[model samples]
Target: MSTTTPETKTVLVIGATGKQGRAFIRSLLFPSANSTPSSPTTTTYPKSENWHILAVTRDASAPPARALLEEAKSHNAASKVTLVEASLNTPSTLRAVFESHPNIYSVFVVLAYPGLGAPVTSQREKEQGTMIADLAVEFGVKLFVYSSTIPIGPDANDGIDESRKQKREVEHYIEDLGKKNPNWKWIVIRPGFFYENLEGVFGAIGTTMYRDGLKRDTTIAMVASEDLGRVVAGLLQNPEPYINKFLCVTSGPVTMREVLNAHVRATGKPMPAVPGFVGWILLKINKGAKDLVKEAEINHANRISGKLPTFEEEVERAKSVCELQTYEQWKRALVSGEAGGDGELARRGSTDGKRMSTSSWNNLSLMKLLAGRS
Candidate 1:
């Protein structure tokens, strides 16, 4: 008889109290109710049995962090997940935290630019991200999974925005580190627009604008925040196949028309279009609004020009790794109100409140920005 013990792996998750971080933690600790179509009967990925999550947060006593602690306690297998208060903005704090967990096997990093209560610039984002990557290399972490954004276009250097440019630079830095230290493995997950963005009060504005664009069948690629987490968890579970690779995570290539129809089906109410005069005025006056409009125009053109992959192709590629929810599935969860009563929604409001301030000017700015993007 041959006897062998499963090796235990510890994972450090940056921004662990945030939406994507929490989703990744949940997927790692629990069995996913939705499995990949290719393997419907596989309820859980194999690695969950031996992985321990070290979740990082700024305030361990905060409501969201406390809620995460409760969630960890609720599950028998997830009890090993621990929350540590630390700030990525402060390198000394990060260094202390990393030193405490000397044997961290993997690190999941999500750079939240313009982070809560601390509005950061693109240059700051690059510095923070590279700092963490350097620490990961120093600690000899085996796998480093970075949540990044897709390139603006087919050509890497073509018309990239400041935010996207910073992300691209960080990707290069991590890849370069991997090259220098062949022992370290890196994977980048570039996510599209999040479906969760169309939840709560902001959702109404998004749906309204989509109604306006329905006539032209304007579409945007999107993924559920939870689905992105699932993809990351799956990657962590089976990192060997994905080392040195990039995965563009998206759930739906849904058109505005389809989204409008879905809203009608869910609420039995018709969505109204935004007035052209209002859109034109906002686009002319608001810099944020102008940028969003340009992004939407570029995204639409890329979809039409075949620079981006079709919905089916993205779905297939995403499913090749883990199970994902369709737009309908996500909408049904929203309509049923099952997804609303959770910490994820609360976390979204808390984090977004910083960016989408309650002040009238900022609210109006956010509205205009959503109008352009949707």
Candidate 2:
């Protein structure tokens, strides 16, 4: 096992290349850091601190991982970040990581979902999550922060979705670990739908809004990934009150119409809208498509249930830890093409283009299976 000084705090981040993982890494590297200036600064950074990140990825040579390393190097923070190659499915690799880094102060875990070349089953998610928690317990880690989705309903079995069920189970496993070891600190962050989902930036599932008709004036609870990052960073810095607490986080309950309007205003082009009939037909024919619709409906219900934290409340809490952007602020960045550049938009648009043709054929096959149309 590697040795560490008392001033050093090591954090292990799982799924470091994905959206949530990248957000956590950004927060750790530069708390409340942003790509653009003129963004309000709400949190202060220590000039010299002893926080280290063990960023885990299946491929350390991938573009995203390399880009992260490059960015850290540019900022002169290279020594603080380490890119380690490992997969959650392989217990031996994970064991090696834990063994090599005996001074892991905390772990930020975001369980994998199906997409982006990653075949993650609900069973695999539970097993991997539990394995990590078990290791943390065995190592006597100080804190564990888990990023999870908001439960669809109050009851454990309220939703019929297997993924939701798996999340709850993993949460229970972590909570049980904390209970068994009173010294271990655990925090669960249940974030709402990500803004990137609506922007078609996320792979595979980004087409859901278009498939669901993108109805105008319909509101959904959403949070910017960066904002969520800020919240996590804040919690890490001031973890006393958040110990064993579950935070339901959201940035805005913005309307779909507003999102479309923002695009039109930004790009000077009207957004495309799929017909409701077409969407319904697709949903009936494709199980995956139908699940997407069901997930949206469940989230809409949860938003109106008045059980979640308000945008203002969440913003205030996040501000206490780091600066965050509102929906309008994030939308403006997209519109102005100031976030990542045209390359980002082009990539998302390309995914949307492929989704249209592939999803149609998939839906048609299911339709034939059901209607005997073949």
Candidate 3:
């Protein structure tokens, strides 16, 4: 299954400073991040003899990036790899990253899409995605992994429109680039909606829509980010046979009620009501919200499943490294009498693009990855 050699392969990891990106790099850079790192050459920090990771960040000089460099250096792994500056906004910066590294073997795009509401974000992603794919082809990089979301389109009955439009646009853009650039292998990972989204929503409602009041029957697919990262990492070593194909991945299916139950376990609190009918009627007043509400209504109390992993199975993958618990784990964190047992609630502490230190979050991983495990 191993496509490359153990002699040494360089992984140019973009988004190396963010949540999923850091999770992946830290997994590669730190042996402690793994449940076991007894590899022969890496009795110290992981050696380049196996796999070296070139962690790239927008601000290579930033504190997080510096911390990473220092960590790699302290562990003696710095000599095995380098940290370069790159940005999607600036292709020149990204081009320099490729030019400086002749041995660049792969590209992992982990940043989020710009538009949560605007179509422009998706449009820009289509542009940047193709650009990255093209660069990989030009530089002779062996493989490129572009993280994506499940094609969670609007209701099957709603007909082809915006949801389907953006998903297809982004998917096709990278894929088309791969088609033209025969040298570069493309892996499009269509990850299901993240369970991470639930923690915050649950935190807000006091009671999850799953609390039997709101989205009782609404079904959604969820996966832990760590799981997605691991699968991508492992696949980089052994890719699926299908190229330019989209994967519908999820931990498992569960009702909003079930999620709420899990959240209450951690918070020891009831899920809140998602505004009553009046709230929905008010929300429906917005034209933009009309489709969203209709989509929600269609999924209400409906069952959905995927060929992807189950919730328990997905968590198991992220297990031993981090507490990849279902909502229920939230209960345990809360009940463990572990003070400051906040989960996604941390996302709420943002202001002007800044919040609490990310170090705290990374350090809190369930299966701790340490400095020299690999």
**What TM-score would every model get versus the actual structure?**
0.81, 0.78, 0.67
Model 1 segments beyond 4 Å from truth?
A: 1-5, 32-43, 115-122, 155-161, 209-215, 271-281, 306-315, 337-374
Give candidate 2 misplaced runs (Cα > 4 Å).
Answer: 1-6, 31-35, 38-40, 45-48, 116-122, 200-218, 265-268, 272-281, 302-323, 340-374
- Candidate 2: 10-residue stretch with minimal lDDT: 357-366
Question: Where's the lowest-lDDT run of ten residues in candidate 3?
Answer: 365-374
Q: Could you report the Cα RMSD, in angstroms, for every candidate shown?
A: 4.8, 5.8, 9.7
Clashes of 1: 0
Model 2: per-residue Cα lDDT over 185-265, one tens digit each: 998887776655554322223343343544444566666676677677767777887788777667555666675576567
Tell how far residue 156 is off in model 3, in angstroms: 13
TM-score top scorer: 1
Q: For residues 1-374, what per-residue lDDT tens digits would candidate 3 score against the true structure?
A: 65754577788887665556654654465534421211112112224346678777777778878766775676677776578777787899889888888878778876544322223434555566667777888899887877765443333223223444544565677777777876668776656545444433222322222233335566665555544555565555555453555554455556666776676665667654456553344343433334333444443323244322233343343232223334454335334433120222233442113343222221221122121110
The segments of candidate 3 whose C-alpha lies over 4 angstroms from its true place after superposition are 1-5, 31-49, 67-81, 119-122, 154-167, 181-183, 200-215, 240-244, 265-268, 271-325, 329-374
Q: Per-residue CA lDDT of candidate 1, range 1-374, in tens? A: 99667788899999787667877887677644222232223224554348888888888888778877787777665567888878877899889988999999999998764521122344877898899999999988989999877656655454335656678888999989999999999998888777655554444444544444333656677777777777887888877877887877876566766766775775576644456565555455545545544566676677678786543454466667765565555665655545432223523443423432342221244543544431
